[model samples]
Target: MSAAEAEAAAGSEYPAHYKVMLEKLNEQRQLDQFTDITLIVDGHQFRAHKAVLAACSQFFYKFFQDFTQEPLVEIEGVSNTAFSQLMDFTYTATLAVAGEDEAFDVWKAAEYLQMQEAIKALNKKIDEFSSLAARSTSKKRKIAETSNVITETLPTVEGEHVEIQVMGEGAIEVEESGAGGSRRRCKKCSGIVRRLRFSSSR
Candidate 1:
C-alpha cells in the first residue's frame, strides 16, 4: 500500500496535505529523483515511483507485489502517450491532454492499467463529447429537412409567382400572382417553406 492509501485507510481526510505531497512527488518525477521503477513502452522510457503506481493501478499493484529485484519493466499493448498521461494522473489526480489522440491513448492506458477512477472520469468525458456530436447532427438534419419540405411544397406551375412570408413564429403567408392576385394566410404551419423561390425569368 502507498502512503496515500494508508492515510485513506486510517479515515484521515487531509486534502491540503495530500495535495502538497502529490505536488512534491510530481516534482521528484520531473527531476528523475527517487523513482524506483522504470517502465519502457514502445521503446519510450518512463520513470516513476512504484508505490504511487501501485496505489493508482491494480495492474501495477500486483506487478510490483510479484516483482523480484527488477527495477526495469517492459510494458506492451498501450502507447507511450497513454502511459505518460496516466502517470501524470497518478501523481496529480488530474490529466491534461492536448488532442484527441492523446485523450484516446490515455483512456486506453487507464483501462489496461485497471484504473477505475480514471475510467469513470474518462467515461464522463466520452458522454459529454457524444452529446455534443448528437446535437450538431440533429441541427444539420433539421436544416436539411426544412429545405426538402419547402421544395416539395412548391409544385411545377407555369408562370407561377408565389411570394411566401413567415407569419409570426409558426405561420406563413402565401401570395399567388395572376389576374386575381390571390393571397392565403395561416396561423399554424403544417409544412416548412422558404427554400424554394420562383425564377424571375419564369
Candidate 2:
C-alpha cells in the first residue's frame, strides 16, 4: 500500500476510539459523576471535573494548578448559552452554536477560557466570513464597472434615443433604436450590448 493509503487506514482504525471515549466522558459529566468543581455563571451552576477542563482549557489548567482549592468558582462576563456550549464542546468534542451571532458569542467565551480547539473553529468561521465578503465586494465592483462603461462609452447620437427604465433593484433597461441586438445577462447586469439591460438575479 502507498503511504497515503496506509495513513488513511491507520486513521480509520483510530477514529472511533477517541469518539467513544469523548462520548463516555460527556455521559459522566451529564450524570455529575466524580465532579470536582462547581462553576457559577450568570446564576447558573455547572458541575464538572477539573482534569477534563484543565486538559481542554488553558485558563482552567492554570487556575486549577496555581490557584486556590476553591470548589465553587464563579466565571464572569460570559453568557449562559455560550458557556454551556463551551462546556458541552469540552466534554463531547462538539460545538453546536445555533447561528452566526451565537458562534461569535461562543468564540468570545472560548477566547476568555483560552481553549485552542474552539478558538481554531472560530478562526475558520472568520476566514469563511472574510472570503464571502471579498467575493461580494468583487461582484459589486464588477457590476459598477460594467455600468460605468455603458454610461461613458455610449455617446449621445441624433438618431438613437436612450430611454431609461428601472425594472428592479440595480436593474436598468436602456432602449436604443435598434433590433437583432445581442443580449448579455448576469446577476448584476444583463443585455449589456446594443440595448443595455440590467438583471436583478445577482
TM-score top scorer: 1
Query: Residue 136 lDDT in model 2?
Result: 70
After superposition, the stretches of candidate 2 with alpha carbons farther than 4 Å from their true spots are 1-13, 129-202
Highest lDDT, which number? 2
Tens digits of per-residue lDDT, candidate 2, 1-202, equal 9999988878755688889998988888888898877665654567899999999998788767754455655565677778888998888877666555677778877776779998888666655655665677777879777532211111111232222232332332222223775343322332221121212221
Q: What would the TM-scores of all predictions be?
A: 0.62, 0.59
| Candidate 1, superposed: residue stretches over 4 Å from native | 1-12, 98-102, 146-202
CA-lDDT, candidates in order: 0.64, 0.64
